[model samples]
Structures are given as structure tokens and as C-alpha cells.
Target chain A: MNPKIAAYLRDHAPATPCLVLDVDRVEQNYRRLMAAMPLARVYYAVKANPAAPILDRLTALGSSFDAASWEEIEACLAAGARPADISFGNTVKKVSAIKAAHAAGVTMYAFDSEPELKKLAQHAPGARVYCRILVENKGAEWPLSRKFGCEMGMAKALMVKAAEWGLDPYGISFHVGSQQTQTGAYQAAIARVAMLFTDLRQAGVNLRMVNLGGGYPVRYRAEVPEIDAFGDAIMGAMAEHFGNALPEMVIEPGRFMVGDAGVVSSEVVLVSRKGEDDPVRWVYLDIGRFGGLAETEGEAIRYAFRTPHDGGAEGPVTIAGPTCDSTDTLYEKSNYRLPLALDCGDRVELIATGAYVTTYASQAFNGFKPLAEHYI
Target chain B: MNPKIAAYLRDHAPATPCLVLDVDRVEQNYRRLMAAMPLARVYYAVKANPAAPILDRLTALGSSFDAASWEEIEACLAAGARPADISFGNTVKKVSAIKAAHAAGVTMYAFDSEPELKKLAQHAPGARVYCRILVENKGAEWPLSRKFGCEMGMAKALMVKAAEWGLDPYGISFHVGSQQTQTGAYQAAIARVAMLFTDLRQAGVNLRMVNLGGGYPVRYRAEVPEIDAFGDAIMGAMAEHFGNALPEMVIEPGRFMVGDAGVVSSEVVLVSRKGEDDPVRWVYLDIGRFGGLAETEGEAIRYAFRTPHDGGAEGPVTIAGPTCDSTDTLYEKSNYRLPLALDCGDRVELIATGAYVTTYASQAFNGFKPLAEHYI
Candidate 1:
């Protein structure tokens, strides 16, 4: 544990687990991503961590937003972001949400099917629209291409249908599956989205923009793809596919924008054994799978643990949240070494959890109090 | 779908994927369990749902509660359950929580370690306590036999230590595990706990209460163990082990009492296909993994889905929740028959989800709001 970080926690923070936002870290991440993708309009995926302070900082730094819901869209609007600069990127949306977006004067929303277009026409007629295209890869861990996007062949038909219904179809949108580690997958998606745009233009569908929805991988663990190279490769592929004469570029970067900017701190309740065959120690903390770490899929984002008084490395110990459910183990087995003699009431901090932590991940189980957020 | 259930939803219910509690069903479940277990005192585990109406019904039925936190204790107390009838059972509790429980005049709590006992001592000195004994389980799905219990001999020592600290050391408590399928496991736990009682008595530690912590499996599907057989086997085992000489028995049953008493109604927003190669049908609903079914544990508990119109035994379909995450699938591939052609705006009911079905299961993800509870 860093002595200074530990000392700061002891002196200032409460015993409750909290989501901490560091402006310096967020600014650094934003600047670094912008430096890599200088040409593409960087839209911060507000759903990742939509805290007002973080959104305000990103807006001041000239980052646009990708909002999936009206609440998020309103959050961005309240944070001083222009509606035209934001994209209602979730392909599946409610009629009320679309109507609200239209009333709020937001122009673009991603749509997948003929039915969605009809709903959009009823709710937000003649609204600026982007057709979300489904593209699949057999080898991807999670193929978002599976069911989200519209087919390339059907894109023209959908656009025609949109026109017939008096709705203005803008362009195309595609989301490469999240936590994408393969750069080639993103390059392929860019090319596919670009091809769809060219096809639509050929079909006389006068497109204005192309949105590559957010799936930028935040390096939760060791094997995550580097953001800079992936961004550069995607841009190069887009240039090659659309001959650099393509419509305006938009990329939704959720985890990439704010995942590493936040930390969660909680006090240890007990250091007990999780099971018997393993005399392994458990550090039970105040947070669980509910508070922003809802990776119940077992593909949980890895977290770094630190204590306020760690003077030495402790043996392998599993960290658990206070929820009585046995499935609530945070660290199944210790990946990091920690100080020995760690007792109950010790405070620990989980690092780089800012993306989907706290308010976004709360369930009122075990009568657990929701975590409060703090900005630094 | 039952016509009455469907009509009730169409007129009285707000939408599909909303939680509905049948007060009659819950009361029947409570009465059946209490009647089945004549030898043991039923302590409804408030952590399961703890909805005020459910708590009130349980309290009215003369049931005590096993509260895991101060909020649960407060919930029980607010519902007219006397503090003396509730046990704050989380061994490792927050100091403030312990104080709150004490202030409510909750006299007894569970303790597993000396450090936790020390903290509880500080908060509620001279509090009545039950030393948690970890029963050895060689093979059990719930290996909480791993994280919580005191080793047989260690429990004897902890009891002695508690007595020395001016704490009233009551009988023993052992949690077999939650959602336990194997009825024999309870018998094994009972025998072990009974032997521990004998050993403790030999060591001059006599206590009047013995808590076989509740792990009564709630049948979410048809394949789960029969509750009657499970209860009969456990009671028979108890009779064989201690006969009428057994200490006052306390059992904590959470899901078993309420799992089948509730239904979540949701509206299908859109039904779309992925691509040519992808054959999965995505039936998007307003309810997601985070709303009212968060305890499904990455699709751990599969609820029966039925369209209110007509669900015939016809074919298999993939059901996706409204959350934007690719992993937000409620049922990856569900086999069910529908009598009608299901389309957008159709309501679907997910059944056997009373436990952990309401406020405890919802996070504000995907803009899907939690349904308000109204007991009928």
C-alpha cells in the first residue's frame, strides 16, 4: 500500500465504501485518448460513469457524449453539452424516451429495425437518425453483432422505409462487442460501417454522419488492447474503406474515458476463511457485487486492493463483500500480495473502478446502504 | 398463462416485468412451512424480500426473523416484530449497525470470530450471543462451510471466550447454506450440530437454543427438490439425532417462504434478428438483469416466461432484457410454446421470483425503473 494514499484515506474518508473521482487522472486519460484519435470526435459514453463532476470536466475538455437513455441525455444537457453533439446510441429505446429526446431537441438516435423506425416516426418524426448495423465475427468472446445491429442488405430497405415514413435517416452506427481485445475486429467494423455508408449513398440515402458506438476496452487486466494503437488502426481502416471522403466521424468511448479515474474504498468487516480445504484468508469489506462491480458473469473487471496500514506483503487472501451470499466473493483468490496480520476493521481501496461503480450498481440487498460519491 | 393472472395484469398491473406479490400465496407458504416444521421455531429470513407487507404478514403469522443488518432489523421492528423475537445474525457487523440493533433492544447476535465479538462487545456489551459453528461439508454447492463457520473445536473455544467476556453465550447456530438442494446435507449438519451440543455440554457450556440456519431451497424450476420431502427428511433426522431432548430449534427460511408467490410482468419492446448466420431471436423487454431479477446471478435462476396472450408449447426463443450491456441476457435460449404470434408491446410474465424480486434486485441500469410492491 502507498503510505501517502493510506494516510489520506485515514484522515479524510468515512468507513463507508465510496466512489472517488480524481480530476487529474480523468483529464490525463482524456488528453491521452484525444492525442491518439485526433481526427475522430471523441464522445464520452455517459452511461459508463455519468457523475456530474466527471461529465462537466469532459464537457469542458470538448468531449461529446453518447447517451443511451433520456436521463443520461438530460444529464449531458444539464452538464452544458449540446443536444446535437450527443447521440442517443442505444438501438433499442422506449417511445417515451425517444419523444423526450425529440422534445429536448436532440437530433440523432440509432435504430436497428423497421419496427423501431415506425416507433421513432411516431415519437420523434423526421428526427436525425442513424441505422445501427449488425456485423458478426464467429471468434469473438461476446458477439454484439449477434442481435443488436441491422443487416447490411436490409440497411437500404430500412432507409427507404424511413424516408417513406417521413423520417430523416442520418447515417450508420456499429458497436464492436465490448472489452474488445482484438484490433482487427474494430478495423473490420469500421470498414463494414463505412461500406454501409457508401452503399446507402449509392442508394441515394444522403447520409450525414457515421457513429461507431462505444465498446472501447478499458484494460481491466493484463491482456487488454492498447487504446492508442487500436484508435489509430480504426482511423486508418476508415480512411482506406471510405477514401477519407466519408461523413463526419463519431466514436463512443465509455470505459476508455473514465474507468481508471475512480476508486472505491470500504472497511474490512472480518478476515475469515471462505472455505476449509483452503485455509485461505478472506478480507470482508463493506462493498459487494452490487456497488458498481456487478460482474456476476464471473468475467469481472479486475481490481487492485490496498490498505491504510499495510506495512508488508500479506499472503494470498480472498476479499469478500459484506453481503451474506456466498457468491459475493470479490477476489476469488488473491492475485495481489498483501500485508500479513490484516484484521477486521481494516480499510481497503479498490482502484480503477470509476466506470460503472457506485450508484449505477446498487441493489438494496442485505440492507446495504448505497455508496456516496466523492470528487477530488 | 392463467386468464385471471393475465386479466389482473392487463387492467390492474402497470406493465409486464413488474413485481406482484400474492399475499394469499405468501401466507399459505408461511403457514405450510410452520405447520411442516412443528418441532422448530420458524424465523423468516428478512433478507430475502423484507417488503413491508411481506414482513407484516410474517409477523402476523407469529414468525420471528433472522436479520442480517440493522436495516433488516428496523424493517422487522417497523412491521411490528418485537426486537426480542429477532436475531441480528450477521457475525461480522458494522459497529454502528450493531449499536442500532442494540438500541432497538435486539438482544442476541451471531458471532464467528474473537475480533468481531470484540467489536460487537464494544457496541453492545453484555449482549446475548450465539457462537456460529461451521459444520464440515465435504461436498456442497454452498461451501459457506468455507467462509463463515467456526471449526468444531474453535467454536467450543469461542463459546468459552464469549462467556469470559461477560457475554451471555446461548445455543449454537450453523448455516447449512442458502438454496440448498440436498436434503441430506441438512441432516448431516443437524447431526454435526447435535454432536457439538453434546461436546459443549460436556465442557460445561449449556445453552437452551440451537439454530439450524435456514438454507431451505426455493423451487425456481420443476427440477428442484421437493420441499415436503426435504422438510420431512430434516425433521426426521432431527428426531433421530436428539428426539424431544433437542434444544429450542430456530430455522431461518428466506426464499422457500416466498419464491413462488410473486411474478414480474414486462413488456416486449422489440423483437429482432441478428443476421443471416445468427438465428437467435432477441425479444427485448423493459425489464433487465438489474431490475427485479438481479439475484438471477448471471442467469443462475431461470424464471418461467409466459406471454399473457397465449404461450403454447411450441418452440425455443432467446429472451433479452432491455439493458444495453451485451451480457444483460435474462434467458440465453428458452424453450416455450406460445399460442399467439408474439410481437412488440406484448406483456411477458416471469414466474416463481418472489424472493429477492423487488427493491433488493433493482439497480437504475438501462433506465428500467423498479416496480412498486402491492400485495394482493
Candidate 2:
């Protein structure tokens, strides 16, 4: 655990199983991203840690927002962000939400199908619309399945349809995947976008922007490249592909901007052995899959855990959350190792968990309150 | 969809992506269980669906409750249930929750660990306690992982410890698993509990009760045997193992009692082809994994879906939920076949979803409201 975070926990004595976000770290992360990619516009994805304080801090730092629903647009507006600075980034949106977003003065939106384009034209006529092109997201830690984007043929047709339907064919957008680590994935996606841009221009549709959707990674259990490395690779790829005709570039980062800035402190509920000869012990914590850490779905994303009892001899342990549901077990297959002395009531800090924890917490499962969030 | 539920939706026109619970069906399910297992007391597991109306109806029907937390106990109380009719059934519970349950006059509780017994001694002394013995949970649809119970030796030790700590060693409890279809699994678990009962009696810890934990299956996609088959198997096993020495028998049933009594009505959000050559068409619903259908975790539990346009010849489809997350796809791997005429704005009803859908819904993800529930 970071000494600063430990001290903050000690000083405030906030409720256990609560999320603590370090505002200073968030600012530093924001500044680092801005400094690394000077030419690209930053739109912090609001679905990640949409706590008012995080949004206020980012809004004060002049960060734009990538909102998926009208509630997110309202949240951004309440945090003092201009509607022009918010883009409705979800390709699949409710028609009423589209009208609400348009009426709220939000103009930028994303779509991937002809039906969605028709909905956009019906609700948000003359809105700046971007068609997302599907890209191969093979190397991402959390590869987005074919849930969001469209093929090149469909994308070209959607852009043309948007123009005919009286909506501005603003640009193109693509998400490599969440927690994306490989820079080559971005390069490959950009290359695909460049080819599509040429094809769209030849078909008489002028694009003005390119949304490199959020997938930048954070250092959790695995080592990931720094922001500067990704910035350099993206800049080089854009230059190599589009040369001097690079459109206004924008990046939507959810995990990278706030992942390292927050830590979740949970109390150990129980420490027991399943059998006498069992090699690994089971450690149950107050927070779980439903509490906040839903990203541990299939154990694809592993968060770094710490106990104050660290530095003792390490032993293999299976960690679980405090829920009656069987699927609440967190690291039964991941081979998580914790200090031998860790027991019930010991505090375990899950570091780099700021991004996707809070908003995903179930309201009340088994009557347990959702994981509370405490801002530092 | 049940014709009654379809008519209910057509007449009421409740919001889309909402759960419609059939109260009359719930009562029928309760009566059917009562008729099947006359010797066993039924405790409706409150975690399944703790809706106030359901609880009130069940309470009026003189149904006992299996509460997992203090809030559930309170919910039962508010629904007019006596404290003596509630059992604190979760093995892992907060110390404060134990105190609260004890203070609220709940006497029967379940525990499987030494630390939990010590907490019970501290806060709920002299309370009736049961030790949940670990059992083979294979062959069930949703197997209870090693999160709940202890081995035979540990169970014996725990009962001795509970007696020593001034708590009544009341019973032994074991859950076969949720959606447990095999009646033999219940017989096996009962036989193990009978052996433990003999051992505990030899150790001078005479137990008075036995809890056959919740696992009874409900018909969704697969056909489940009638409740009478399970009752006959359980009674035969008890007669064979403990012959006329059956203690005060109690059974907790979550899914079996209420699962088939509810239908979730959701509007089709989008129907688009990823590629024209792709065989499987994508059907997106207004609700998703976070919205309440989280039991689709691994596509292990497949709920039967009905479209009003159901008879137009079936075609393969990949069903997805309306969330920005890629993991929200519900039935890509489950081989869901829907009517070819199903399109956007059409209604789809997920049957047998009354048990675990609403309470597990995340509050707000991607700005979409959690699945709403309406009791009919």
C-alpha cells in the first residue's frame, strides 16, 4: 500500500470496503496524459468513476467528457462541463436518450448502424455524427467483442446515410478495447481508419475528426508501456498513415486517467482452510464482484492487492468476496498470494482500482450496501 | 411467455425492460411445494426476491423466511413476519449483523467457521445455531463453490464448539446448489447430514433440526421433475439413513418457489448484421447483464425467451444487452434461436427470471437504469 494512502485511511478512518480516490494523483495522471500527447484532445470517459469529485476535478482541469447516456451528460453538466465538450460515445443508445442528449445541447454522437443513424436523424437532426469502424482487437486484456463497431462496408454506408438524412457525417471512431496494452493494436486500427477515410472521401463524404476510443492501460498486476510510449506510437502511426492531413484527433480514456489514482480498502471477513491438507487458504473480503469489482468477470483483469501484514512469508491464498452467491469468488483460479499473517479484520488494499469499481456496484445484493466511495 | 403474462403486459403497458412477477403463480408454487413435502417446513429464501409485495403475500400465506442479512430480516418484519419465523441463513455474516439479528429476536442462525461461532457467542449467545456441512455439489446447474460450508470433521468440531460457547447446537445445513436438478444430489447431502447427526449425538451435541438448503430447480430451458419427485427422494433417504428419527425438518427453497413465476419484458433495441455473410444475426435488448440478468454469467443458465412474433420460423441469433461493455452479450455461446421476424421495438419476455434478477442489478452503468420490477 502507498504510505500516503495508508496515512489517509488512518487519519480519516473512513468506512471499510470503501473506495478512496487521491485527487492529487488524478491531477498528476491528467497532466501526464496532456503532456505526453499535446496535439490530441482528451475526453475522459464518464462511465469510469463518475464520482462528482473526480468529474469536478477533471472539469476544472479543462477535460472534455465522452458520455454514453443522457444521465452521463447531465452528470458532466452538473460538474460544470460545457455540453459542447461532451460527446455521446455509445453506438447503441435509446431513442429517448438521443433526443434528451440533443435537447441538452450536446451535438457530437456516435453510431454504427443504419437504424441508429435513422434514430439520430429523427431525434438529433444536424448533429455531428461519427460512424465507428470495427477493428481487430486481439491483444487487449479485455478485448471488446463484436458488440459496438461496424464493418468497413457498413461504416461507409452509414456515413453516406447520415449525410443523406441531414446529419453531419462528422468523423470516424473505434475502440481497440479496454485495458489495451499493445501499441500495435492502435496502429493497426488507425491504418484501417485511414483506408476508410480515403474510401469515404472518394464517395463524397468529408470527415473532420477521428476518435481513438478509450483503451489505454494502467499498471495493475502486469507491466504496461507508459503513456509516452503509446503517444509516440499513435503520433507516428497518424503521421505515417494520413501525413499532413490528420483530422482533429481526440482520445477517450477511462482507465488510464483514473485507474492509478484510486485504491479500495476492504476488511477481511474470514480466513479459513477448506481442508486440513489444503495447500491454499481462503481469504474472504467485504467487497466482491457485486460490491464493485465487476471487472474481475472471468478473472480477465487482476487488481494488485496489499495487506499491512506484507513482508511476512508469502503463502498461496484464494480470495473471495463476502456474498452468499457462489460466483463471488475472485481469485480461486488466479493463484493470488498474500502474507501468511493476514487474517480476519486485516485491511487489504486493492490498488489501481479507481477506474471501473464504483459505477458497477450493485445496489443491494443480500442486503449488503454498495461499496461506499470516499474522496481524499 | 405465459399467456397470462402476455395479457398482463398488453393491458398494463408497464415500462419496457421491467420484471413482471405473477403473484398468483407464486402462491400456486408455494401450495405445490406444501403439498409435495408435507413433513418439511418451507422457508422462502429472501435473497431470491425480497420485493415487499412478494414478502407480504408470502407472509400472509404463513411462509417462513430464510434471511441472509439484517436488512432482509427487517424487510421480513416490515412485511409482517414474526421474528421467530426468520432464520439468519448465511454462513459468513458481519458481527454487527449478527448483533442486529439477535436484537431483532431472530434465534436460528447458520455458521461454518470458528470465528463466526465466536462472534455468535459474543452477540447472539444462547441462539439456535446450525453448522453447514460441506457436501459434493456436482451435477447441479449452479454449483455452490467452497464459499459456504466445512468438512465432516470440522462440522463436528464446530457443533462441539457452539455447545461449549453457550449456543444451542440446533441443526446441520447443506445446500445442494442453486437450480439443482438431480434429486440424487439432495439424497446424498441428506445421507451425509444423517451420519453427522449420529456423530454429533455421540459427541453429546444432540441436534434438534436439519436444514436442507435451497437448490430445487425451476423449469426454464430444461424440464425439471415435479416437486413430488424430490420430496419422495428426500423422505426415502431420511427413512433409509435415520429411519423415523428425522429431526425437525426444514427446507429453504429460493429458485424453485419463485423462479417460474416472473417474466421480464424488454424491448428490442437494435437488430443489425455484423456482416451480410454472417449466419447469426445480432439482437440487442434494452436490458442487459448489469440490468438484472447477471445469472447469464457464463451462459450457464439459459432462460427461455418469447417474442410476440414467435411463429415466423426460427433463425439463429446472438442476443446482447444494451450496455457499452462488451461482456454484456447474453447468448452468443448459448445457441439462442429466435423468430426471424423479431426486430427493433418488438417485445421479448424472459421467463423464469423472478428469483435472482432485480436484486442483483447494478444501480447505474452507462447511465441506464437498473431493471425495474412490477408485481402483478
* lDDT of candidate 1 over A100-128, digit per residue (tens): 99999888878887778888888988887
DockQ of each: 0.46, 0.72
TM-score of each: 0.91, 0.97
Candidate 2 off by > 4 Å:
A1-4, B2-4
Residue-level lDDT of model 2, residues B38-148, one tens digit each, is: 888999999999999899999999999999888899999999999999999988887778888999999999988888888889889999999988888887888987888
Best DockQ among the predictions, by candidate number: 2
Candidate 2 true-interface contact recovery: 0.66
True lDDT of residue B192, candidate 1: 81
Per-candidate local distance difference test: 0.74, 0.88
A124 Cα displacement, candidate 2 (Å) = 1.7
- Clash counts per candidate, in order, are 16, 0
Q: What is the lDDT of residue B372 in candidate 1?
A: 61
Candidate 1 wrong stretches, greater than 4 Å: A1-11, A134-147, A150-160, A163-165, A198-208, A219-226, A274-279, A296-299, B1-10, B15-17, B133-145, B223-226, B276-279, B311-313, B333-340
- TM-score (2 decimals) of chain A in model 2: 0.98
